[model samples]
Target: MTISTTRKLVGVSAAAGLILALAGCGAAPTSNPTGSSGGPTAAASFKPCIVSDSGGFNDHSFNEAALTGMQEAAKQLNVQFRQVTSKSASDYTPNMQALVAGGCTYIVSVGFNLSAATIASAKANPKIDYAIVDDPADANNDGKTDAPNIKPLLFDTAQAAYLGGYAAAAWSDAHGTDKVGTFGGMQIPPVTIYMDGFVDGVNKFNADKHKKVQTFGWNVATQKGSFTGAFQANDTAKQTAQGILNQGTDVILPVGGPIYLSAAAAIRDSSKGTVMLGVDSDFVLADPSVKDIVLVSIMKRIDVAVHDAVMAGASGKFDPTTYIGTLKNGGVGLSPFHDFASKLPAGLTDELKSLQQQIIDGKIVVQSKATPKAATSN
Candidate 1:
């Protein structure tokens, strides 16, 4: 019934190596799971829980992806699960404590904002197993997990964003604007990593094509740029988007949860046909309303990572080793162009494929100061 006893059953199920299929935003199962959902019902004591950041569970982005994974795992395990949403920074500790008080055995913290609370909760309640998405759970700069019970679900999104940036540059070049822009919700590592890769991707495009394509809203060397200050669809996010658009950028990549919605609005209102790139989840599929304007999305398979972590815990194989998602392992990738496939320049798709293989083959190395390195076991 405890995590200690669960470890004896580790890797007993073949489902441990199951491959995750790509999923978009859909009506997930209710937070409460019933046996009728499907699969073998786990022990009643095997409870898996999740806590969302300020964006809530339906932000059509990172939080939503993590929530969807937890829901699917609970359904497959056929056990009841709990989820709490934090409306602000102050809500993290209380939300985590609520789940602990509710007897959650496995906890998934949905974003970097919940890192401190998740670590503290794990240390205080050594019996519970924990996983944190998009954060390494290293409170000190020691390069090791602060809590042995906490697992880190991280993604190297810079690799995928580089590809998206290249595509954005190609789109802009074909449109004759030869300019792209990117903005984030905040200046955190998770958000800036995308900007770093995107700007580098644009630079790569310029080098390959012998053309000059300017990138706005972010400067990789200085590591400074415009941010909306929060991951919300607000006037500030819209205005930030407009500022980038005013720079004559033909394409824009918005790196935040729901803030992309604000960018889409800015693009629509401008009537200049400025395309955009999505971060976290596939915006075109996650939110069909933006399908017309989204050229591509830099995807981080958070759902897959979360599902694997929960399943591992359910089977008592809760290893705290850091799980780093990269292009080689299908952890991060670019979503299908969908509506923009035909609109891109000729041979761009082939060029992207070549570049992807090169990155995988180590022919091209994408560097970002914010890039996450897998934690070494202490």
Candidate 2:
């Protein structure tokens, strides 16, 4: 890949500053700091906070990605920030309330599970700026955010997932199986978007290669398939992955957060020779334990987006503009093949690059009903 194309693929340069700032990030503050370094004088009192979903910040997924951004923001601004981890859905409101009570100037709720609580908090406290990850915050289905204070941090993951799906299908075809599968954490829009893109990618591969590759877990037409119903790495997730693997699938895409761990375990135990795909964050780098079995990750630059949003808020530039991650920008794309690079088919890498450009050029439209609108792609 060329320099510009590599930048678009995984947002390496966009995230470099945040990664550098992470070295100076301290633990959650017991009390707010006195002043900030890289902001206006009024920003001395700016206190940003974050709350994680049930998966906590150690899920090696979106929650962790968001926390990384928050830490980087705090470090660069030279301010202390607070954080809360939710054990279940019920803790969302209470967590947001605690942050509000702590006099947080800007709060970020990580994940779609906290959308309701984020909207409620934003509505109740109009002075505070809020941002939500992986949700549009369209509580009434009116196709807009419910509150002005809340900024929607959404990702067009389907575009990147299509690339992943096509790569998986090609890998399976090269292995002579021509069978792939996918399962999600839940039936929600964020989860299903990946499945939808994967389905289309496999169809594209079949049409292009004139081969019959079967997708086992997800059915795009009926919008029904296997799901663990939760984003936990547990027995249910493992069993769901095993069920997909039992169908003789050569590759499987698990759409949940930490559920990919269970799928990785399933891949390791069985003799199916099945590889897995990751979502949100790169699994191979996030958790090296699954590096051997993972093919590639459909990555959304959540950390970079979160950092930019938090920085803007700290500098008194908070806007409710919806940020959409797409292939055109460095927002969403696939990770490198890593160890699996040598195992791929000869021309597969070049083909994926061409397809990515095609998608960016609007030649290949990866459609999904769950795609976010009014997108300010960055």
User: Runs in model 1 with CA error above 4 Å?
Assistant: 1-41
Cα lDDT computed for each candidate against the true fold: 0.83, 0.81
Tell me the tens digit of each residue's lDDT in model 1 across 162-242.
998888888888885998999999788999999999999999999999989999999999999999999999999999999
Candidate 2 pairs with clashing backbones = none
- lDDT, model 2, position 272: 68
Q: Best candidate per lDDT, number?
A: 1
Q: Encode model 2's per-residue lDDT on 265-316: one tens digit a residue.
A: 8988996678988888778778889888888888777776787788789878
| Candidate 1 local Cα displacement, residue 86, angstroms | 0.7
Candidate 2 regions exceeding 4 Å error are 1-42, 375-378
